[model samples]
Target: MNFIKSLDDKVWMTAKARYNASARLNKKHQALTFTISFLSVAQIVLTFCMLVDICFGFPEKVLMFIAMTTSVMILVIANQSALGSLLIESEKLHRFGIKFQSLYEEISLYIKLDKANKSVEEGFQQRYSQLLREADINHLKIDEELVKAERKSFELNPICALWIKFKNLVAIYLSSFLYLAIPLGLLWGASWLK
Candidate 1:
């Protein structure tokens, strides 16, 4: 009875550990998403400010240029970080799925062993069978759900790839705009000063 109790406790503990790890991963994902969104917003705001400064002959044109350049760099970095995190998360999930498959195989082997031991206590056999059946059903359901999730992830992969490419292009364009504006602003300022 103690042995069965210990096994049950161990199983529950393992499940709890996995749950915690998954929760932590989810939190990290959310954080990355928030960070990327914030950076994009900041970039847009800074770009607009730079344009306004250029139009109004704002005295702090150099500062505006610096702000715009900095924002663009930050946005690019944030986008790349988000993409890297997503790739890491996908790999982790794939590895976890494989681990679950191994766990299922091990449990199935235990069930088979119990079945072959006819001399085992009747109550123990019955309980073992019930637990095995429940675990099997749960495992199948989780596998099916994971498959669906993986399919969705694959579907989104191309979209994300395109988005990353778009971000890089935008970053390059913004950088060039800032670079060109500096010399133009300097010439304009010089003429105005004269």
Candidate 2:
């Protein structure tokens, strides 16, 4: 009886952990949509600016070149990665996460009601596995770092936290650097207009 009780508890605990992980991954995948939109728009604008002769100096051209190159590279990577189907798959990741959320809720209700039903317990386990297989997408290390930061779980070492924070900052601001400098250069060049 004790062994069986422990097994049941383990299943429930595992489900909760999986839910937590998937929820975080879903959020990260959603960020992919923003990332796509941001880089795509920035690239289009920069490319258009280049076409419109926004070149203020060699520096502006260099900035534009760097921005567009990063955009193209990301597009290629998106297509080649599990991030395939780009926005659509990213959306799917969110949808699957919703399913996981539902499953977690169901597990909670069952636990509150009666956890001794082995058949029901097996069904829950199977459903949990199925959800995972259907989702079929994995989160990245950055996603893990983001989740850890969000949860403030106190498991992350200080050095590791700082490392991930630096990486996150770079990722969040990289696109800005790509497109922002052109304006600065143009502003400085505008002085020549004076």
TM-score of each model, paired residue for residue? 0.38, 0.49
lDDT tens digits, residues 10-84, model 1?
343333333333433454455555544555565566567666664344445554554565555456546654646
For candidate 2, lDDT tens digit of each residue in 1-194?
Answer: 34344444443444444444455434444555556666677667767777877754545646565565656655653664334354454455556656766776776677667557777777777887777677676444565565565445447887778887777665545544544454446545655654
C-alpha lDDT score of every prediction, in listed order: 0.47, 0.57
* lDDT of model 2, residue 102: 76
As a TM-score, model 2 comes out at 0.49
| RMSD to native, candidate 1 | 14.0
Ten consecutive residues with minimal summed lDDT in candidate 1?
A: 136-145
Could you report the Cα RMSD, in angstroms, for every candidate shown? Answer: 14.0, 6.9
